[model samples]
Target: MAGREIVLAEKIDLHLCWEGKQLYLKPIPTFLLHHDFFTHAICTAAAPPGSTTASSDLYASACGFLKSYTKLIRHESDLAIAQEKNLIPASVTWNQWCDFSADIVLNTTGMILSQRYDYGELRLTRLNLLYEMHACEPFHWGDHRYKFLLDTISHEWLLFTFVYFTVVLTAMQAVLATQYGAGSVGIQRAAFGCGVFVLVVAGGSCVLMGVFVWLRAYVLFFSETWIGRQQYRIYYLDRILEALVLSE
Candidate 1:
């Protein structure tokens, strides 16, 4: 019989090796480059025999990729809003919604393209998205407050975006530091920059986490508002109820 081939599917597990120990985690999607996955796949499929290459081909592919990322982000953004509003389950598998979100960072376009070029394309693109998400996700909280304890949280797409970037950057920086001398100026600078990036990321995470915690705790323990005769309803809720009551 001909030798059997093992084909990796869109989903795979991430394994971490430490001190000869292996840790296998949940299933994650392979990197599809969202917008560029098909384009790149086609290009690679039809790639000219190392003979005909054009800058336009690369640029066109990149533009397509960006469009794809935007589309995916928009889709995820909507889903996150829905989830926050308690329209979806908090434990819903990310992969169940978007394969792109479920993909493991290491398997993404950045890794595949890294060796072929001077730099990795997917990773950089991801970082750009991540930076935007990190800076913007917190503001969404103000817009998505629930009427009560069971109300959904909004802007979760932003949270996952941050998580993926954090994981990727941390791994990349650690590898660079370990493989290259940690004391070397280049490594030190890279590490420092990575540190700052991570600090900002961590700060964002903390803010979001804190907001959720506060909202949940406040809803559970405190009366809604003190401005009304009801005396027990939240202030915002009382106002809303009053408006409804008067509208009749």
Candidate 2:
């Protein structure tokens, strides 16, 4: 099994863009069709129960997609039965029907995003979620958010605490927090550099310290739970020159 060559049967290209809070997926991908998580995501519009913000029209469309896609896929431990009597399409194999179902569901993506926007969600599609996990040095191992949490009781307390922390050469505690960022690394480098140059400053340290503390908290929150607890290790795939969803 180790040496076996696993051909990538599903190849896709995905482009993610952002305008304000809404993450616009240029064209919805079809590879997510087979996954149970994706099915649930679309069906629920990723909305909460009794939430009025969720668009019913979108929810209905999502549900409509599930109705057809989930029709033939039933519970586990069921004996396979011939569908000749049901006149099931010859092209619809077990793994075969996924492409079609994905197409049907993708048509309703606009509605899905509409419902999602109400909740302030849809930050990133499942495909890129895995890369954001800093399992090694940054998010979890370095314990960046530990003392930062304690200093959050009040701003005045934080100001004095930060002053003392910086003088003590304990700045490394915040290295994880300081280096972390959201946008392009180039932008982060500039922002981080500003904090470093003024690290031991007179009054400006307070401002930079505040920014670092905020960053640690941000990384902590996002690593554990993405915006609205929406996605984790998600993936999808699309065609070559096609939309792709990875780890859907």
Note each model's CA RMSD in angstroms: 21.9, 21.7
RMSD of 1: 21.9
TM-score of each: 0.26, 0.20
Residues 170-202, model 2: lDDT tens digits: 443344356453435765566566566656464
Task: Give the per-residue lDDT digits (tens) of candidate 1, residues 65-147.
Answer: 33333333346565574356443455544566565344432123322221222221223223323433464222212222343
Off by over 4 Å in 2: 1-58, 61-96, 99-121, 124-203, 206-208, 211-248
Highest-scoring model, lDDT:
1
Q: What TM-score quantifies how close candidate 2 is to the native fold?
A: 0.20
Residue pair clashes in candidate 2: 12-238, 234-247, 235-246, 235-247, 235-248, 236-245, 236-246, 236-247, 237-245, 238-244
User: Weakest 10 consecutive residues, lDDT, candidate 2?
Assistant: 6-15
